[model samples]
Target chain A: MVIPITTGKGRSSRMHEFWEALTDPHVDFLRIALLMGLLASLAFGMTGSLVVVKRISYVAGAISHAVLGGIGAALYLQTVHGLEWMHPLLGALLAALLAAVIIAWIRNNGFQREDSVIGAVWAGGMATGLVFISKTPGFVDPMSYLFGNILILSRTDLYLVSILDLLLLGILFVQYNRLQALCFDEEQARLRGIRVGWYYTLLLCLIACTVVLLVSVVGIVLVVALLTIPAAMAGQHVRSLGAMMALSSLLTLFFVSLGIVIGFLGDWPAGPAIILVAGVAYLLQSLLKRVAA
Target chain B: MSEPAVIDCTEITVRYGPVTVLDKVSFVVPERRTLCIVGPNGGGKSTLLKVLLGLVRPQSGTVRVLGREPRQARMRVGYMPQYVQIDPLFPIDVEGIVRMGRLKGRGLGFYTREDRMATRQALEEVGLWEQRREAYINLSGGMKQRVLIARALVNNPELLLLDEPTAMVDAHIEARLLEKLKELHNRMTILLVSHDATFVSGLVDEVLCVNRTAEIHPVERVRDKSVTRLYGEPVQHVVHGHTHHHGEGEEQPDA
Candidate 1:
């Protein structure tokens, strides 16, 4: 595997004509972005498996949309409060988790009519964030939020993402059995004294954390697809409810990485192209599962 | 053995939208006792059991099991769902399904040896210990019912709620299942829901009749008129040694 590095490698590799040949900033940015697209898909796929096992596609989508508000919160904090302590992903995650808690509370409290409220929040969040973005001075470009500046993945970004991913995987593994039970039957889960509300909240937090990296890498536009398709496809193929997750994470990495390479060669937009790759994989897996059965 | 009320339901009422399935019903299922919910089709038998297990909440009622709410009491409770409508090809093995009963804790972890032992004991109790390795789909109807019971029993529940446990079984196997239930009732509290009023009446200490309303009847006098009063049924049940038979004009009984 080619290990990712920064700084001295570029400077030292300048002597080699082939490595030095691509001097265009646009091409270099795009090249890095292709890799970022793959990483985004991996994050999305892992989170998707979480969504699938929890049967929370609607919740995930609602949470993803809620991230828009999180982004706005981060912006507001940084600008108004002059707090450099905020990161975009962290802010978004906090907001999304809050939304999850609210949704679960509403559902448990018999406020069945409030599901539509999530949709309203979705629109309102994006609109609020967009308006904030427009009013910000010297912001230059907001393309990073809509599409992505994946080409700008510094070494620090990769390291941060790697740590986050490990933490996510660790949390999932530690509570593996509980996740399986929660996936199968919530009633049974609660009977086992699994605080259904709290676990649900934790799941939302994990999903939000996962989505933060996904949004950062691939932008919000393509993140939802990456979060849903692979896990869904994996669920249909795997025998046990738990195995579906392992398969999903693997499938997610494969398609997204593959898509990035394809987009790289084709001079295409990496985020959307990578997500399409996952879609195609899902279609193929469906066909295969059908044939096997 | 200490005799506690494994399932205690009082003034429980269940409604499905506009249709009220069970009206204010009360019962105390003492440990080592068998209580059956017997009535015609569309009677509130299943709903009553569900309420007792906290699977379905009653609109206005008080329910308790082992001195706790049904939902909280569920850990010590085992359930055998009806086999009539389920597809055979549910993609689980007989023993695997049984294992689910024991490993149902909130935490994430591998099942322990104790869980495996429970599965073995439950299978043996149901007489399918020999066929423990069989695919659930490959089993006959009676065998499937036994397997379902085994699944519930594996949890070593203090209370067992059997919803139409023998509905799809053959007559001979139904009798055999009855024997197994009799043996199980010597240890845990058992509640079975079925339209086979006379049959269940012979097996249990008491019969709880449920239609739109619930009426408790002792085993000695659960005749057709009592059945009709609770369920408005035209059918008649003749009690045999332990089996209940509907007359020729009676519609097909669903469990």
Candidate 2:
């Protein structure tokens, strides 16, 4: 699993090296990383559409920032207590689900002001993570998790991402109409006996899972950008939620793949490059729409 | 007018912490008739509607919608909240919006042929069948109101509840909506909530004046001074044959 870090290499040599790494059976991290990006795009597209339309990007952002706490705790436990099974990804999934449920509970129960609670969770999660990371024994580079390193992803990460993809597809297959109703008009949906609270909680849980997937691809700070930008851009053109999901999924795949390639060519960081490309394209789309109008 | 009660509320009382939003409110709407619930803002108009729809729980009173609990009868009840309550930028078309009404508490099943037929019929009833493919965001305010009405109609409920249907639309659109509701009155029980009671007085069979407490009066009796006492001001009544007036405090209550 040792990956040689080659920087300041010529553009042509880097391109040649990436291709060589992709084809070399013994060195397949590059290929796995590319496949991971493609797989993550499916989730980014579907859940991102719901997140954007439901106007819960702040909630999603809170859930994502909360993931760092889980990762840090898992790293601390594994390093100090020899808890070999407590993988950082497992810790992340648990933390994301916990954050989603807490936020949903607060909203459903009316216990506290929602935005303030979300703000607390958003900052509190990161602060907790920072403390845990500081306490860990090894020199853990938080930057890799704060801003992801797609090249370091493993076969296990690929399997986890695939499971998440299938899980999301299955949920959407069953709950698409209900989710649509929930998003468009919650009160009417409740009048129809749609269990608006439960569906809302379920939607947040899905967003939690999607945030975990994005964390592996783009990390925490950049997850919201990748999660929302494609769907927001797609919304400007599509007339239906389904079409928005489809178009956004394509856009996500395009940005992730192109960003990966460009990062390889220019010897740049992959996660931020992907976000930068998405940000630029979104700005361009908005500009073009204004001009057309 | 003894067609059986479609909605029966017995001493319904609702309180938000220390503030009692509704107190000892009780009324009934007969089947196949239109009833307008009129009141000032924050006077429990919307809360009463929520009680009927089983959204807000009462501390001590019982609510029976169509001879069953409000939640139990939800599938048989169609509700149209103010169109302003919906997100204007929601990315759904007319057909998609109407199809949402067919969701019967089951999250897994696909839309059936019966659902599609009902959607089409609802759209046609609202006179928006031709615009079913148009995005809801692109629709005008009047058309948005119609789309909401169509959504409420898609389920073919026995009881229909509309909240502030004429809030943002013009007089002409309100008249057209009135015509549509009058046509629907022959099939189902209708309860509409409005702060401006005069706009719907011509079409409703009764008017329920609410201000923390509740009282029901026949539509013809709404012009009586007691209705004015309920509002603490003079209330205008629109006669069927006269041109509608938009000016404030210029027209007299029709005798």
Residues A1-293, model 1: lDDT tens digits: 11233324443353342234235554464445545545554556566776875667777777767777778778777776787788776777777777777776776666676668667656766776777666655563456666654545675667667777788778767775566556555655665666767667677777777766667655766677777787777765545544656667677667766665554444455566677787887788789878987
Clashes of 2: 0
Per-model fnat list = 0.31, 0.75
Candidate 1 regions off by >4 Å?
A: A1-46, A76-84, A138-143, A147-150, A289-293, B1-24, B39-47, B54-73, B82-100, B103-110, B123-148, B164-186, B195-205, B233-255
* lDDT (CA) per prediction: 0.68, 0.87
lDDT of candidate 2 over B1-255, digit per residue (tens)? 477889888998999999999998888877888888887778899999898888899998889999999989988888898988999887889999998889878646579999999999999999999999999889999999999899888988899999999888888888898899889989999999986666776688888889899999887665546566776765554434464332244554432
**TM-score of chain A for the candidates in order shown:** 0.80, 0.95
Q: What lDDT tens digits, residue by residue, belong to model 1 across residues B29-106? A: 676878788777777777787787777888988998889998878878888787764444333456766776665544
Q: Name the docking class for model 1.
A: acceptable
Give the Å shift of residue A39 in candidate 1.
5.9
In the order shown, the candidates' DockQ scores are 0.31, 0.70
RMSD of each: 6.5, 2.8
